[model samples]
Target: MDQEDPGFSAVGEVAGDRVTVRVSGEVDMATADAMFRAATPGRVRAATLDLRAVTFFDSAAIHTLVRLADHYPGALKVFPSDRVRRVLDISGLGHQPWVSADQG
Candidate 1:
């Protein structure tokens, strides 16, 4: 599924048991839910969130990511942009096993 807002977009690609959702633009209260929904479609063994293009991320975005991490457990991986990384670091979530600067 693909979701688009004025300054945000989330597009998902599925391969076998894994779903990779690429998110761009600003992620705030207005777009976080949509991003979460787009990231998780039905049931998948694993999920990858690519937020390297996200220019802005807020608390709502963080909450959405946390929810997704919980939903996918150890199967969730997040590739964060520098902007998102700063927020995640400040929020103490950047050190999470799910979060990685490397694309892998």
Candidate 2:
């Protein structure tokens, strides 16, 4: 979202009724807000946050994902990188309702 920080980058594109967000770089306290905002643009029937490019993830990012899951239910989904997946697993949030390796 903010180009000021080179450590984080996120982009979103609408596809039909769903939005697909591609997020890369660190997601820490400094970048979580930008990541969240990029992942969720507004109300939508379905959405997907693809974190395959993310290199770092932290507690703030985890909390943001949890909140997104709670707010969007089945409409919200996430595809995380191996590093991010480990963080989710360690945090016990990987198997949550909105996180999955495959949306189908």
Candidate 3:
């Protein structure tokens, strides 16, 4: 349906050693790069992705986060929405230490 549309955005903020990215709308192939750039605008010791406002989470989003975690180790964290949590679970990425599903 309309779910296959491109409608993703990300906003990043740096506070001390932590970089927080608040993402809204949908995340797909077309918007993944934008999300990555906004989420990791610069190097930081800690990173948090606020996905609570995201209406949709797709494979592109998952891949981006996984890659980030791989490169940054404990530098990445996620505050995922229930919708995103389900996707992670289905994708077998729910157990990732970088993902905090308890934020709900």
Candidate 4:
């Protein structure tokens, strides 16, 4: 599934029990909900969030990611862009086990 709106885009790929959601552009209050919906569709056992292309990430985006991480618990992984990483680091979630600069 893929959705695009102005400065934001979210693309989701499902493989068996895992879902990978790649998001780009500005992710703020306006697009946070849509990003959440894209990441959590149906009963996915695991989720990978790829935000390497995100140029801007806000608190709402962080909240959305937190919700998704909580929903999937240890099964959630995140690959963040430099901008997103700075925010996550400031917000104290950058060093979490689920968050990594490497896709692997």
- For every candidate structure, what is the RMSD over all alpha carbons to the true structure, in angstroms? 3.1, 2.8, 3.3, 3.3
Writing each residue's lDDT as its tens digit, candidate 3 over 1-104 gives 23334456688999987888898888877777777887665657778899998888889888998877885787788999989999999999999988895783
> Per-residue CA lDDT of candidate 4, range 7-63, in tens?
798889999999999999999888999889999989789999999999999899999
Using lDDT as the measure, the top candidate is 1
Q: All candidates' TM-scores?
A: 0.92, 0.85, 0.87, 0.91
Every candidate's lDDT: 0.90, 0.81, 0.82, 0.90
* Candidate number with the higher lDDT (1 or 4): 1
For model 2, residues 1-104, the per-residue Cα lDDT tens digits are 44335857878898777888888889888888887777677656677889988899989888888877776777888888999989999998888767776623
- Model 2: weakest 10-residue lDDT segment is 1-10
Please identify model 2 stretches exceeding 4 Å from their true place: 1-4, 102-104
Residue ranges of candidate 3 with Cα displaced over 4 Å: 1-7
Stretches off by above 4 angstroms in model 4 are 1-5
Return model 3's CA RMSD, one decimal: 3.3
In candidate 3, residue 54 scores what lDDT?
87
- 23: Cα error in model 4, Å: 0.3
lDDT of 1 at 57: 96
Best by TM-score: 1
